[model samples]
Target: MDFLTSSTHLHITAWVVALVLFLVGAFVSKSKGIHMALRLFYILTIITGGALFIEAMDYGMGMQYGIKFLLGILVIGMMEMILVRQKKNKPTTMFWILFAVFLFAVLYMGFKLPMGQNFLA
Candidate 1:
């Protein structure tokens, strides 16, 4: 669909996918099925995010795009650390805090700020 090819559509879709993953991951953190689903969702999140970044760069929105990429990496790293690390230390609280901060930042970028002038244009 033409909408899928549009930058706005891609951006929105990325956010939707990320949110869904976050929610489902939370709900099914202890289940093998949910864990597998979350993992696949994260992989898709990364791919879609990369596509969005490329689109932004192609449109000359480099700084904003770079910030987004960095944030994404930070979030993904946090996620991996939370999910893959051995349960030696109790880090759930810290991970949740980090996730909250990242979510807030994403919201600021997506809704509260002038995204076009801030990042790409």
Candidate 2:
């Protein structure tokens, strides 16, 4: 139980795995297996993230957590949007750009915000 909540362990782990999965999907564009794995990672991310958000709320950091949570979901959405566009053989330049921007923002906020990892600390 302690491990689950400690230092946002679960949430971080899920995101790391999801990142790897995302990369796999990107590299293996036509692989349904990679796509399925990426989808699973998305679910894992959401579950772990929800747990962390609830914990944050208990510590009176709900607003900060909420923003991060939404950004995280947006990141996932961007990934799916890219995949969808690719599947349809449509241009994905815009979605790719948005994904990169959102990914940077989410990572920056997660490590910089006081309510988050505050990696500098």
Candidate 3:
């Protein structure tokens, strides 16, 4: 469906789902089911995000797009690090804090950047 490939729809939908899953994992107990679900959401977010980046390339935004792509990967990495630390019974506070910071950064960039057809557009 055209809607599925549309950058706006895909990015927003994936991020919203990922954010909800992140909240659940952070605030509530992390169960195996939740972990798998979160992984699925992460994959979906990356795929959709990559698609958005490719589409945005046509607009010739240059390094901004690349930076967001890398930051997005870091955000995902931070999330995985948080979960891994938790599973290892290690100190997750630092990872959790970093995750939050990176998440905020990604969100700020996503909203501020003139990339896709956002809701305000």
Alpha-carbon local distance difference test for all models: 0.61, 0.82, 0.77
* Model 3, residue pairs in steric clash: none
Q: 118 in model 2: Cα distance from truth in Å? A: 3.3
Reference-based lDDT, residue 52, model 1 = 61
Task: Please state every model's RMSD to the true fold in angstroms.
Answer: 4.4, 1.9, 2.3
Candidate 3 CA-lDDT value? 0.77
> Which should have the higher lDDT, number 2 or number 3?
2
What TM-score, over all chains together, does every model reach?
A: 0.68, 0.87, 0.85
Which residue pairs overlap in candidate 2's backbone? none
Off by over 4 Å in 2: 1-3
Tens-digit lDDT string for candidate 3 (1-121): 3455564777788778877887788669678787788889889888888777777777788578878878888888888888777778899888778877887877777876786545444
Please identify model 1 stretches exceeding 4 Å from their true place: 1-5, 8-11, 14-18, 27-29, 84-89, 112-121
Question: In lDDT terms, which candidate is top?
Answer: 2
Candidate 2 weakest lDDT stretch, 10 residues: 1-10
Rank candidates by TM-score, best first: 2, 3, 1
